[model samples]
Target: MLKRIISGLVGFILLLTIVIKGGMALSISVLLLSLLGLYEFNSAVSKNGIKYVSIISYTFPFLLFLMFNIRGLGLNIQIILFIYILSILSILVLKKDLLLNDISVTLFSLLYIPFLLFHITLLDGNKLIWLVFITAFGTDTFAYFTGILFGKRKLCPELSPKKTIEGSIGGILGSLLLSLLFLKIFNIEHYVQLGILSIICSIMAQIGDLAASKIKRISNIKDYGNIMPGHGGVLDRFDSILFTAPIVYYYITYLL
Candidate 1:
């Protein structure tokens, strides 16, 4: 418990610092996290000794970041994806040891980690980007204590036994609290949109956590990795964020 609290605090502080620093700092931090996340995911899924196109998998992330930022290499997004698809397919054909299962998992890793997380950089303003973490982390914090105090029914016993219905409500309420606070600070009046977004994100956050757990269950592992002492790995810690980032990004993009 002590380790959990300490790690959470340290991680939160580091996150707040980078978020405040925005721009290249935020982009690079998230990029590094995506790489680490991919590494952790590959490590987890390969427990059965499945061989993935590791070199290609690692290279694409760097290539993606470069394409987005380096103006000279302004290749079309479709072109980039086309090249990536062919690269992996070529490796699959050449390597008899590699199966479609490995290729599928590799594709999943890219979409799940770097691709989804890249949206954080897409958000136009500081508070908008902050919305992603605020909803995710706030819901998480409130849900933890709320569950301890009033939890009685299991939310998802098969995926995560500790979660309860009470905790789930508390999580949504937590997200609302943080999101409302955001509105107040920014002096915005779009109450309905933000409220709906907060609730949706909270539910999605829980789903994201369960989704990661589902993967771990299939792999027959207790945790993704022991990198965070109490939290497992980048995937474990950012699972909710992974699901929420895209939601927040699109909400701000088209709805608002």
Candidate 2:
């Protein structure tokens, strides 16, 4: 327990440093991490029997870097998605032996997994970005300890066997408190918006956790890579962020 807390604190400090710097350092960190995420996604897809995983995986980092470098009306993302879609269509047409449904599934997975996660970095320093991750990390931290100590009823028997409904509620409430705490600490002057955002972030974070669990179930593996001792892998560490980021990004940019 102490080890995990210490490791998490160290990791958070390093991340805060990189983020607070907010320049090429931050951009490169995000870019590299996103690339690592893409690699993990591609690795997962390959296990599911997707051909040309290497080519598709490499494309994401290149596309992201290119889009990041471009200056203009910011339609680069749309263009990239369009190009990806067209590429999928072309691949489907070229592979005579592949089923139409299989090709479509592969293409959809390719676009959804890495693309959505990568989109979050574009939001950068928005409150939405911080809200999602902080709430997620908060929820996960609360849920684990709470569930282990006090949980009696299992939430899901298959995907995440140990999680409890009570623990989940505890997580949400814990996330809410943490969100308010952050607002107070930062003097951000946006309480209502932050509360709503906290709810969204907490929900998405749970969803991301479940999503990662589902992936592990599919792969029949325990833990993604175990690089973070108690935390698991990079994917495991950031899964909540993966789901929360897109939601927060959209809400902050379009709705809130």
Candidate 3:
């Protein structure tokens, strides 16, 4: 418990620093996080002992390039897909021992993990970005403690035994509190819309966590890695962010 609190506070402070001072600081932090997340994701898929070294190696640069070149006739998007195809081809040449199924899994994993996550940070508005962060991590925090205290019905016994319906409710309510607090703190426009977005983010965050748990359960592994002490791995930490950021980004841009 103490470890979780300390880590959470330290992480929040680091994030606040990045957001408070935007530009290179913010971009670099996001870039580093994206790369680390890719690494963790590669690790998750590598549990099968498949030779995916090339695919994982190319993930960071491909995601970063895709992020910066998001415009211009959708060429960037096409190029990202091209790279994935090349990665699949490379596996045939470079890792001759790897079979078709292994290469296919690696391709799917890259497409979903780093490639999908890269877009979330590109969205406008620091407040919206911060909302993604809060929604992702805040929901997890609430769910953890709530489950510890009041969880009764198991949300998914096979994937995550501790998760419960009670805890999920707490997660959503906690996200609402954080969302309202940030809106009030930053004085952003559209209070009602932001609240509704927060609800969406909270639900998506839980789904993200559960999604990662399913991946872990399928892989038959414990924590993705011990990168964050009590927090498991980079994937474990950013699972919610991976799914929630994209949703929030889409919402802020398209809907509200």
Write down the lDDT that model 3 would get: 0.76
Candidate 3 per-residue lDDT over residues 69-169, each given as its tens digit: 44454556566678667867776788668788677776766666666566554753455788888887778888889988999999988888989999999
Q: What is the total number of backbone clashes in candidate 1?
A: 0
If both were scored by lDDT, which would come out higher, candidate 2 or candidate 3? Answer: 3
Q: CA lDDT of each candidate?
A: 0.86, 0.73, 0.76
Query: What C-alpha lDDT does candidate 1 achieve relative to the native structure?
Result: 0.86
Top-lDDT structure, candidate number: 1
Point out where model 3 deviates above 4 Å: 55-75, 93-95
Steric clash pairs (candidate 2): none
Q: Count the backbone clashes (under 3 Å) in each candidate.
A: 0, 0, 0
Off by over 4 Å in 1: none
Check candidate 3 and list the clashing pairs.
Answer: none
- Top candidate (TM-score): 1
- The alpha-carbon deviation from the true structure for residue 9 of candidate 2, after best TM-score superposition, in angstroms, is 2.8
Q: Which segments of model 2 are wrong by more than 4 Å?
A: 1-3, 72-75, 95-106
Per-residue lDDT tens digits of candidate 1, residues 1-256?
A: 9999899889889988888877788778878988899888888888867676678778766766776677698765577778888988999999888899999888888888888887787773557788899899988889999999999999999988899999999999999998999989888778889889999999999899899999888878888777787988898899999999999989977899
Worst 10 residues of 2 by lDDT: 49-58
